[model samples]
Target: MKKKICVIFGGESTEYEISLRSAASIINELDKEKYDIMTVGITRGGKWKEYTGKVENIICDRWYDDSLKDVSVDLGGADGALIVYGNGKLEKVKIDCAFLGLHGANGEDGTVQGMLKLAHIPYTGPDMLTSCLGMDKAYTKIMLESAGIDQAKWVTVNDYDRDEIMKKVVDAEEIFGYPMFVKPANAGSSIGIGKAKNRDELMSAIDNAFKFDRRIIIEEFLSGREVECAVMGKRGVVRVSCVGEIKAANEFYDYEAKYSDKVESKLIIPAEFKDGIEKRIKETAKKAFIALDGKGYSRVDFFVNEDDGTVKLNEINTLPGFTSISMFPKLFMHEGFSYAEILDRLIEIGME
Candidate 1:
């Protein structure tokens, strides 16, 4: 029997457009022979609808064209089903599992995971607590600290008071000096991230970052090569993939450098590093994932100081991107898993 799979995409997230692209890619690769596919799209305003349009429409941003039926997970029921109501009728669509093609905000920060947990639906990626911990950079730093993981020095700003913000700015400057990275504590895909070299730029970056979330993270810039590793599987049985490096065309790997076609970015898989550096990074990747109680999959990033070969842990992305240039799949594909095979393994893990 073919299993019915619900591919959930989009959300009230800054990465909504990226989510659509990732969904389109996954929907295209899902084997039609073994699973029945269903797509649900959430609009920027948080409206949920059952999309029956062609997959290409999703990438073209036309998936919302025409009338689409209102759809929602049946949270009140024990069965893993979605309720679609429109045209004076209600239909129940049972799903065996859900592919969470979502990023940032309510979708990746455990909101959608909580809903699926209530609906008794198994979904790809981490559970509620893990998702919450992974999405919030402040909390992720806390977890990493507790695990004895070495990351860049950072200060978290949660207070919105003018005086408090200024105080933090002063403290950040005194501690880390200039040229810092400011990012929203709860955003991903490089959204709401700014690099500031002076005090004026730092203030502007903080203000702009706070616009995306109530809290923000300020970190001293670390000069090194940006490398990443892909991890999957549940606790006690995790798997790690080859490391990859990013050579951003922009001043840094901002959103544009990551996704824009106009910008030139280079991705080096099986990144060349000194002996034992790659092995140590892979080991740290597994350690960090297990420390966070990560499940399903994640991409752990790091910064390698080329001079002394010191590795500093970067953030862990619980639901990494699936876009054409995404490193998650590319790293695994280098390990001999086809895109479809990767999705298959994730689904199987979610079911288990």
Candidate 2:
């Protein structure tokens, strides 16, 4: 019998559109012979809808037009089953496992994971605690520092008081000097990240970041190559994929460079490196993932200094992007893991 999988996507997040794109890709690629698929979408306003439209429409952003009217949750099984109320009746599908293509805020920050846990259902990606830590930039810093991992110098700013927040921002620049990065502590997909080279820009960046999140992470920007690695499983038996490098067209790897300007930005698979550097990066990736109590899978980013080859931990994305051209999938694909193979492996691990 086919496994009844509930592949949920499009959440109340800044990455909502990205989630839809990813969901379409996965739904299209999943083998019909192996699994029974239930498509669920959460709107930006947080409305849950059962989506049965063509996957292509979801990718094209028109799934809400026609097919969406065909399905709605059956309140009978309120425990989060993929239920559908159609033809004047209620139908509930008992999901064997769930694949969350949701990102940022309510979805990626352990909210959905906790919900699934309460429902006693298996879901893909890291467990609740790991998801929460992975989404928190400040907590991730604490974990890395405790593990003796070298990372960028950072200061977290959460004061609603403009004057106090301004003081903390200046103190950070005084310590690290020059170019700094301001990011929302819990946001993903580079949504609220800004690079500032001067104090004026620094202040503006913080103010802009606060619009998206209550807490913000301010870190001294490092001049280095932007590289990343994809990790799977947990602690002892974790597997690391090949190293990948990103050359952003913008001054920094901001939102535009990540999803908008495709032709300008470039990704180098299996980044060329010196004798021991690649191994060091892979080892560091595994260690950082394990140190944060990371389970299932994540994409660990780093900045390798050019002059001295210093590898500094950037952050861990518990549930990274799975789009066709996404770094996580592309990195593993380069290492000989097909997209379908990766989906199957992740689903199997989630069941465990």
Candidate 3:
């Protein structure tokens, strides 16, 4: 019997469209002989809907032309099967495990993971604690630094006091100097990030960042090559993918550079590095993953300072992009793993 794998995507997040792209890629690569794939779409408003056909078709071909109607799951039902109703009829669908492709808040911030845990269903990617920690930039940094990882100097601010935030910004300027990066501590997709080159820009960036999240993180901008490593599996047997370098066309790698083709950002698989740099980066990436108690898979980013030959930890994406053109799959592909093999490994690891 084929195991029923529910590939969940779309949520109330800035990365909703990105998640759809990832879902398409995964569904296309999943081995049909081994698993029964079910495509589940969650709207931006959090409504659960069951759709027909392959996940790739629904995602890439935009086949969601007609709504499959709304579905309700009776928690009391056996094995938590979803009760689908439409045209005055009903059916129940049982889900064995879910392959989550949702990104950003509500989905990636441990909410969905916690619900799945309570539902007694196994799912892919990190557990609740790791997901929550990885979602919050400020807390993640604290944990990383405490574990002796070299990360950029940062200060966090909440909505408590504007005056206090101003004072902190002044102190940050004094300590970290000019050209700082201000970002929302809990948001992803670089949705609310700004580069502050002066005091005025700093204040504006803070205000802009606060618009998206309650907590804002301001850090010193380190100029270097932006590199990332993809990690998979649990502790004691974790595997790291080849390093990939990101070259953003914009002043900083913002939303435009990430999703839009207008902004030119090149991805270099097996990034060019000096002797021992790649090995050191892989080692540090694993350390950072262990530091946060990460599980399943995560992409650890870094900034390699060419001038001083130093590597600084950037941030970790617990659920990184999985589109065919995305870096995560590209890295593994460059390392001799095909897309289908990557998907199989993720599902295999996820089941564990």
Top candidate, metric TM-score: 1
Count of clashes, each model:
0, 0, 0
Q: What are the models' TM-scores?
A: 0.98, 0.94, 0.94
lDDT of 2 at 47: 71
Residue runs of model 2 more than 4 Å from their true location after superposition: 65-80, 261-263
lDDT of 2: 0.85
Stretches of candidate 1 off by over 4 Å are none
Best by lDDT: 1
Q: After superposition, how far is residue 335 of candidate 3 from its true place, in Å?
A: 1.4
- For model 2, how does the per-residue alpha-carbon lDDT over 1-352 read when each residue is reduced to its tens digit? 9988888898788889889888988887777888999888887777777887788888767777434533343334545465566557777668888898988989888988987877667888998988998898999899889999999999888856566876796689788977889999999989989988898998899889998888898898887899999998855789999999999888888788888845478899989988588888999999998997887889999999857979998888999988867999999888898888888888988888
Model with the higher lDDT, candidate 1 or 3: 1
TM-score of 3: 0.94
Tens-place lDDT digits, model 3, residues 186-298: 88889899999899999999999888888888998988999999998886788999899998978878888888877778888889888678888999999999988887889
Cα lDDT tens digits for candidate 1, 156-215:
998555567878888898889889999999999899999999989998998899889988
lDDT of each: 0.93, 0.85, 0.85
lDDT of 2 at 218: 89
